[model samples]
Target chain A: MITVSNLKKEYGTVQALKGISFSIAEGEFYGLLGPNGAGKTTTISIMSTILEPTAGEVNIAGYDLRTNPIECKKTIGVVPQEIALYNDMSAQDNLLFWGSLYGVSKGELIKRIDEILHLFGLHERKNDKVKTYSGGMKRRINIASALLHQPKVLFMDEPTVGIDPQSRNLIFEVVEKLHQSGMTIVYTTHYMEEAERFCNRIGVIDSGQIIAQGTLDELRKSSSIKETIAIAFANLTDELFQKISLAWPEVKRFDQTIHFFTSNSKNDLAKIILNSNELGLDIVNIEIMKVNLETIFLSLTGKQLRD
Target chain B: MFQLAFKDLKLFFTDRRAMLLTFLLPVTLITLFAFAFGGIGKAKNEVKEYDLPVCDLDLTEDSKTAIAALDTDKAVHVVMVTLEQAQEDVKKGNKDCVLIFHKGFADSLLYGSPLPVELQYDEAQEIQVSMLQRALFTTLAMVPYSNRNNAQRMLNKQFDKLIGGGNEQLKAQVHAQSDSLFKSVGKGVEANPKTSSSTKIAIGSDIKMTKLVEAKEENSPGLIQAVAGTAIMMLLFSVAAIGAGLLDEKQEGTLKKLLYSPMHPNNILFGKMITANSISILQLTVMFIYATVAFGLDIFSHVPSLVLMIVVTAYACSSFGVLLASFAKTRQQVQGFSTLIVLVMSCIGGSMIPIFIMPEFMQKIAVVSVNYWSIQGFYDIFWRTLPLTDTTFLTRILVLFVIGSSLNLVALRMFKKNILQIA
Candidate 1:
């Protein structure tokens, strides 16, 4: 469990995090969903004791992060965005060093290293240097290093970025198993689908502020739009878009596709088709998508989840 | 091809470390070398004055005159000390040579017996010794000849006393004969240059050049200097490279991972220093062992002193490496700065060039560099053959320890501020 209250961070004249607050229950798979440069890494960095907040308080598993950082660090593990392993060292050696740093005994460290290597399916390459491994394999070993000490809470910041699909799936499965075993995890990523699939509760963060936060169903219920009418145009003119925008005031444009959010998709789809015909616009494709995290995020914020 | 070259050139120019290494390092080295070798605005004929210690046991006026003549030379300044003090100074490497005038030196010079002057010197300072010998020979040659007239006067007085009131003619003839012989001998050098060259003038005819502290026959001054200087200079380069490992970790993200651990930031720096120090100690030991085996450096004779010096020197050199790492922001910057600093310090501090060969001011300035103390400590153990309890040896060790401690303290503060605070 973690409690971050009114957390604020400043880098000179820029405010990275603007008094945002959130909490996670025991054994909860909490996902912080945000676009790039959305203060996700900064939040994780502060909570993991890699950085001190400009002004605020964070409590991890009943230890105040600012006051008792060592205790807090003992309770949590961090998987940084970078592959924070020594490339020149073997995976087993790297795990042994990190485990020792966390004050793990030699016997227990060796056992845990073996277990984690087996879990990541990297037992065969344990003796090989990390520099010789594939990118996905390296990412798996990076995650394995953090789990060697078996901390109560784990902070994973985009652990699956740039990895092969198989590695990503394996990581997801392993993390889900950890969650099932009652390990509270705070996962941050910009992938909306991953957040929906893995997180018990999702917090949508953008521009250093959390706009909405809840379960997938709760988030959908909270969003005003139940459906989105997506229309793709071959060549959409400003005049046609303006007219279409005037017709449906809640319309949003993403490249050549214009989306109209509404509670009744069938009615809105007919209206949009007639409007495109009246404006002499060619519609290439059209679809009515039911409410999901993407639509809910687009409804809550004007931009897509990735943007 | 041109486009590729231009791309590389642009990248090189954008890299400040590369630019500094290309432009600034060579210029700095040239300036330091130029200043140390031929000082700025110094006259071409100006020579370094060697300090020569003298213990005049005779204390007679003739001995005084001899010492004064030697002191008057522009090449050497005579420092009068007791025999014990003079021997201690030369043995401790404070002075390269000592001139000891025995108790009967004046009597021997006046009576035309064997001259009684001894030149006690350290054989390790081969160049200084040769220069001193040349200057001393020219100066002391005047002492015996200048006293020729006085020798004639005392002979006439002795003739007056021994032949008083009897055989006036015989005494006068004998006095005239002795006076004529003294005049001929005095003017014989000026009369015929070739004969004067052949005729030994007996300038301290028995002057002995005694080696104050004899070392093993296998050890030569050049060999010792080369081994110690090269060892120290290379040790610095090695430790600097090791220190740059810290910057490598920072770029590689392992440092960030370490920061996330429960260990203190200072512990990471300590770990780096310990690694560098251990490597440096091992490097120096290997170098010394090789020197002993290949060149017969006689290291086993002074093992305790060598070990102490090596440990202290390694500590100081490794501290220098860490300090350079903490000051630089990147590994490239560390490389550029360490190369510049270590090279310049070596040239100034008797590694690339002996301190005695440098100008007086540069020799004084050399003490500020870590290489100076490290090399001097090695010299104390190898060339000077100082004992473990020698004050100079202990001072060198203490100074090195202080340098290491001070640099480590500064590195700790900088590492916390520049590295940990931002990690």
Candidate 2:
């Protein structure tokens, strides 16, 4: 469990994190979803004891971050966005070194390393130098190193950025298994789908403030967006798109597809099909999607998750 | 802390290029110096030989004797030639000096007159001229005794001629008394060589015919100085190389990872210190062993002093490196800073050149450099061959230790203040 109350951080004239507050329960996967430079990493850094807050308090597993940093740090593991590994050292050596830094005994460290290597599926290349490893393998080892001490809470700051799909999927699976086994994890990412698919609860943060925090359904209900009807056409010209927009002023054009937002999808779906057929445009496919995190984020901040 | 240091050592040693440079660069430099300087300290006491061209126009016994003495002297290589040849050789710079014995030199000596010996020498070759002058003076010293003998013989012969016309018995008695008196005077003159010079010539009696103190046979000043200078320089380089690890870790983001652990930030600095110091000690030790085996440097006789200097120097160098690393933001910055500091210190501290030869102001500034103290401490043990308990030796070691500890504390403060803050 982690409690961050009114956390604030400043760098010179810039306020990286304002007085924002959030909490995570035990054995829950909490995702902090935001765009780039939305203070997600700053919050994570402050919570993990790597950075000091300008004016606030953070408690991890009953230990105060400011007063009892060492105790708090003992209960948390941090997987940084960048690969923070000694390229000259083997994966096993890196694990052992990190484990020792946490005061783990040699025999216990070796056993833990073996278990984590197997869990991350890096047991076969445990003895090879990290420099010789692929980007995905290196990322896996970076994550594995953090888990050596088996902390109660793990903080992963964009661990799947700039990696192949297989590695990203492997990491997702590992994170899911950890969460399923009753491990509390705080994951920060800019990917809306990942937050929706993996996080038990999501905190939508923008501009140093968390605008929304709840379950997927709860967030959808809170947002003003009701539904989005997407109609994909084989070919849509600017003239035809303008005619559709003129008929239904709420229709948004995106290349060969058009999005129609409405409060009652049942009525709008029939009307949009009739108008498109009259305009001589073939509707190749139609999808009626309810309000999701992306639409909610757009409605809240007027910007995409990656902006 | 120990584990961190051990990990650093493992990483450093596992890289073959780093290992080779840490051990090989100093040895190579020392070898090159050995050949360049014609063995260390050898230039100070080595006696150089000069060429002397001589012309004996008289061809008399006295001239032959003088030329023989000059030829036999160890300081000159005598070449007997014609007068024209002698002058030409000196003018052409083939020989440093030419000594000419004028005609009637033997007759002038027999009459107790000043002998004519002209010396033509090149003024530019002062050392060679000085050597030639000394050699010539030593060989010509015997001329006074020869003149004295010739004069005594002439006096005896003149007395015999004057008494030949008087009574035979009286003549014999007078001749015997005069001969006895002259023989006694000759014996007195031969008894003291210093007072035997001709009264007309005033070559001072204080001219030393040989060196007052001979160099010690066991120690080579050049080699020992070279070893000490090379050791300190290489120690700085090795410590800098080791300290670069800190910058590397910071750039790679591993430093932040380490901070995220339960360990304090000071543990990381202490770990790096241990690694750098250990490697420095190892580097200097290897250099010493190489010096002893290859150059016959007698370092074992002062083991206690040598060990003390090595420990203190290594500590100072490694601490200085850490202090530099604390302020550097990137690996290239560290490299530039380390190179600048090491080179300047080595230059002023008598590592690249002897301290005694430096300008007075630079020598005063040398005291502030850690390399100066370390090199001086090594010199006390290796060059001066002083005992471990000598005051100067002990003072150097203590000062070096204090300076190293102070730098380490300052570096630790800086690390806590700047590096630990996540900006």
Candidate 3:
């Protein structure tokens, strides 16, 4: 469990975090979702004690981060966004080194390193230098190194960025398994689907403030935008697209697909089809989408998750 | 801390370029220096030989004796030639100087007149000119004084024998006549200004020219100096190379990962220092062993002093590297600053050149260079062959250790205050 209250961080004249507060209970998978430079990493950094807050307090597993940093650190593992590995060293060596730094005994560290390697599916290449590994393999080893100590809480910051799909799936499964095993995990990412799929509770942060924090359904109910009707058109002229936009004020165009935002999608879909037929445009495929994190983020920030 | 240091060493050893630079580069440089300086200190103290061209116009017994003296002198090689040839040789720079005895030089010496001589020399050859002047003076002094004294003694002995055989009255008359004749000759020689004194002056007895004992040819020339100089300089460079790993960790995000663990930032810095120190010692040890085996240097005779010097030097060099790393933000910045500091220290600290030969002001400035003190400590042990207990030697080693320790403390403070906080 982690508690971050009034967490504020300033880097010279720029404020990275501004009095954002949140807490995760034991065995909870909490996701901090935000766009780039939305203070997600800064929040995680302050809570993890990697970067000290300008004015705030963090408690990890009943230990205050400011007063008892070593105790707090001993209970947490951090997987940085970048590949923080000694390229010339083997995976086994990296694991052993990190384990020892956590004060694990020699025999236990060896056993833990083996288990972690196997868990990350990196046991086959454990003896090979990290520099010779592929991007996905390296990412796996990086995660494995963090898990060597078996800390109570794991903080993974954008771990799936730029990795192969298979590796990303493996990581997600590993994270899910760890959460099921009653471990507290704080995951920070911009991927809306990942947050929706893995996180038990999600915190939507923007511009150094947490705008929303709740479950998926709770977040959906809280947003003003409800559902989105997506229609794929085989042939839609510029005049027809303009006509559709004028007929429905909440409609937006994306390539060959036009999205119509409304509270009642079932009723809106019928009207859209009628208008399309009258305008001589063929509707190839139609989808009724519920309010998701992306829609909620777009409504709240007036921008996409990646922006 | 030890585990962290071990991990760092493992990484460095596996890096082939790092290993080569730490080990092979110093050995190669020392070998090149040994060959270039002709086996070390030998070149500076070599016995010098000068060539002297002699043109004796007098060609008398006295002039011949002077020429032979010039030839017999071990320092000079005398070449007999015509006056025209002698002048031409000196003018053409084929000879350092030409010694010419003018006509009547023998008469001038026999009559105790001024010795007529001309020394034609190349002005640019100052050392050779001074040597020739000294040799010429010695030769001229022997010729005039010995010949005149022998002539006077022989005449007196002949008069004594004549008086011993003849009657008393005849002996008395001969003695009176001889005394009167000698007195008149003495007055005449004194009244003649040119003959009053021989221009040839003997080197003063008080001057006491002591020849320096030749340096033993058995010791390898400049090898010890080369080893000491190269060791300190390369140690700084290699330690800096190792210290760059700190920046690497920072760039790769491993430093932040380490911070997330229970380990403190100071422990991280301490780990790096330990690794750098170990590698520095290893590098210097390799150099010493190679010097002893390849060049036959007697480095082991004073084992205690050598070990002390190595430890102190390694500590100072590694600490200096950490200090540089603390101030640098990037790997390139560390390289640039480390190189600038190491080269400046090497230049002033007697690594590239001996401190004894540097200008006095430069020598004073060299005190600020950590390399200067480290190399000087090595010199005390290796070159001077001083024992470790000697206060002068002990003080230098202690000062090096103290300075290194102090810098390390400051670097740790900086690491905690700036680098760790930034992360």
lDDT of 3 by residue, A266-294 (tens): 78778889988999898889898988888
Q: What is candidate 2's lDDT per residue for B1-423, written digit by digit as tens?
A: 999999999999886556545665456545534533335444576543445677899999887876776676676667788877666544433344667788887876675456677776643334445656776676575554445566554455556676676567876776577678767866876796567543333232112222111123344546766888888888888788788888888888998998898888899899999999999889988998999898887777888888889988999999988888887776666776676667667776778876644433556677888888887776566655557876767888999999999999998998888664543
Best by TM-score: 1
lDDT tens readout by residue for model 3, B316-407: 99999888888778887777667666766786677887664443355567788887787767655654445677776888888899989998
Better of 2 and 3 by DockQ: 3
Query: lDDT (0-100) at residue B127 of candidate 3?
Result: 47
Candidate 3 CAPRI classification by DockQ:
medium
After superposition, the stretches of candidate 1 with alpha carbons farther than 4 Å from their true spots are A237-251, B1-15, B38-43, B145-148, B151-207, B420-422
Over B10-119, each residue of candidate 1 has an lDDT whose tens digit, in order, gives 99999888888889889988888888776664657676677788999999998998898778778878989999988887787767778999999888766656568889
Tell how far residue A137 is off in model 2, in angstroms.
1.4
* TM-score, per-candidate, Cα-based: 0.90, 0.69, 0.71
Q: What i-RMS does every model get?
A: 1.2, 1.3, 1.2
| Candidate numbers sorted by lDDT from highest down | 1, 2, 3
iRMS, model 3 (angstroms): 1.2
Q: What overall lDDT, based on C-alpha atoms, would model 2 receive against the true structure? A: 0.78
